[model samples]
Target: MDIALINPFLAAAKHVLKTMAGVDVRPGKPFLKKDDLAKGDVSAIIGITGVASGSMALVFTEKCILGIVSSLLGESYPKINDDVRDAVGELTNMICGDGRRRLAADGFSLQAGVPTIVSGKDHSIRHFADGPRLAVPFETDHGAFMVEVAFGKPH
Candidate 1:
């Protein structure tokens, strides 16, 4: 996979959390995801289509979700609920939007689909595409999570 294609998602995620949640996130060196289970309690997956086709997932631990939602809503959500899920979806949307705008400058005009959310212990989400995924793991004061991106050339 191209780091050129993957960097926007990483940048957007870090920028979003820092600007919106007031949280400074440190991203670990990216690695390829090879059928490994996701290390998250909740994940929001968004499809990218148009110039490029594939998906991106924002996976988060329960504590990470709670911390971000608390900053966004000004109230701590003691647990995961429907509201928490919705917040995750919206956060993913924001990151996708930022990434899309950035990718357009790199010649890929991407469109993001409605986010699909899943929550469970070790819910493994396989990429719908046959390409390798570039997984960027992040560490914040709240917890750790990952941003996984797997995309293809423009159609």
Candidate 2:
């Protein structure tokens, strides 16, 4: 995977988390994933088309999301509920849209589908592209989450 492709997402994730949720995020090293098992308890995924045909997913641990949503909406969520799921979906969409906007400035036209949220332990995330899955781990004061990207031809 090209580092260029991943850079936009890294920046966008940082921007979105900070501006929207009032959370500070630190990105860890990027790596190739070897399995479909989700790294966290919940995830939001969105498909991309146009210049890049692939998918992006944001996986969040329970603690991570709770902290984010609580800061974002100024409300405490004891656990993942319908409202939490909606927030995850919106967060995923915003990240994808912001990243796509950056990519567009680089002359890569892209479009994203509506985000899909999934929850549960040991859930799997299947990307639509046929290529190596690049995952970047992020740390926050509340907890940790991951950003997974797969950009290439559709499978």
Q: What is the Cα-based lDDT of residue 68 in candidate 1?
A: 86
Give the distance in Å from residue 150's predicted Cα in candidate 2 to where it truly belongs.
Answer: 0.3
Q: Write candidate 1's Cα lDDT for 86-139 as tens digits.
A: 988999999999988899998988888899989989788866566788888999
- Residue 95 error for model 1, in Å? 0.3
* Cα lDDT, all candidates: 0.87, 0.93
- Model 1: runs farther than 4 Å from truth? 153-155
Encode model 2's per-residue lDDT on 16-132: one tens digit a residue: 999998899999999999899999989999999996689999999999999999999999999999999999999999999999999999988888999989999999999989888
Cand. 1 TM to true fold: 0.94
TM-score of each: 0.94, 0.98
